[model samples]
Target: MEDNIRNSDRAPLPVGLYPHARKVGGLLFLSGVGPRKKDSKNIPGVELNDKGEIVSYDIETQCKSVFENVRMILEDCGSSWDKLVDVQVFLTNMKDDFSTFNKVYADYFKDIQPCRTTVEINALPTPIAIELKCVAEVSS
Candidate 1:
């Protein structure tokens, strides 16, 4: 027999978007999560420097917020970070902010050393300093 797990507790994001949670086999593929607050704009843009240019941004705050957002998504899907199998982090300035970003990121993911990849990008909406995407395993 085949079983599917879907989370209907969380509000629908959009018509075409996937729901907060979906289970296939024993793995759960979570979508990308951002640092935007619940009431903040749907798309929380990047964080910009004082000069209005995308530069080395707030590593601690942005990283923590990103994790919080991920946690929210996981909770909505009836899971947690402990089940994460991999994580992908996108940065606008990896060379400049890698240290600070690592410091904050390590704190949250200290226990789970899920596979991770960091990539430097040209730009993102708003002044977002960082973006994180993850994959998690759901218990049957």
Candidate 2:
């Protein structure tokens, strides 16, 4: 089959012009999924100061939300969490958030341990602290 761009009505809209995922051959590549819920401006664990800057955030909460968001996109694209082959995790703060994020990630990925990479980034398009890019195998 040809490459098909996929989007989920239940997932948060992308910050930029992009679909939720793209299906090519037997693989599904997901765009970066953040912790924002659909139609909501508030991030899951984000706390902003009066100046609209991040004050404090909960990495565990953000991690769980992001994982669920990835799952939503995968399921919407005819895939499942177990089908994930690779995961690229982006975090704004590696020193502070890595341990918490790793714990949460371990819970979700313990059984379905896919190849994973975690990196620190300056920021995402949104105010979210965590985002995930995933690749999953599409069952024929």
Candidate 3:
């Protein structure tokens, strides 16, 4: 069976129309998660204009917040951090933000390291600096 976690009170709502996480077979797929606060428009480490264009950002802070969102989703879905198998990271400025974001990422996954790929992009749907889309194995 396939299941979707949408608009979950345990995690921040996705900025776009999408599920926070979806389970198919024995794996869970998380959507590209940004650092937006739950039930609020504020984004950590991001300065947005009235039109929601990014003005400035701190990658480390944003990365931490994104992981926190992922953590919440994992917990609610009967999974754990160590279950993560892969992660895809999106950064607006790889040359400038990669190191800081990597450090923050290592702090969380120090031992349970998940395979990761990072890429730089010109923009995201929101004014955030980073997004994390990942897959995890679920113990059924």
Instruction: Report, for all candidates in order, the number of backbone clashes.
Output: 5, 0, 0
Better of 1 and 3 by lDDT: 3
Candidate 3: list runs displaced more than 4 Å: 1-7
How displaced is residue 115 in candidate 2, in Å? 0.3
Against the true structure, whose TM-score is highest? Answer: 2
Error of 2 at 109 (Å): 0.5
Q: Which residue pairs collide in model 3, if any?
A: none
Q: Each model's RMSD to truth, in Å? A: 4.4, 1.5, 1.7
What TM-score goes with each of the models? Answer: 0.75, 0.95, 0.91
What is the lDDT, from 0 to 100, of the residue 100 in candidate 2? Answer: 90
Ranking by lDDT: 2, 3, 1
The Cα error of candidate 3 at residue 61, in Å, is: 0.9
Ranking by TM-score: 2, 3, 1
Per-model CA lDDT versus the true structure: 0.69, 0.91, 0.83
In model 2, the Cα lDDT at residue 8 comes to 85
Say which prediction, candidate 2 or candidate 3, comes out ahead on lDDT. 2
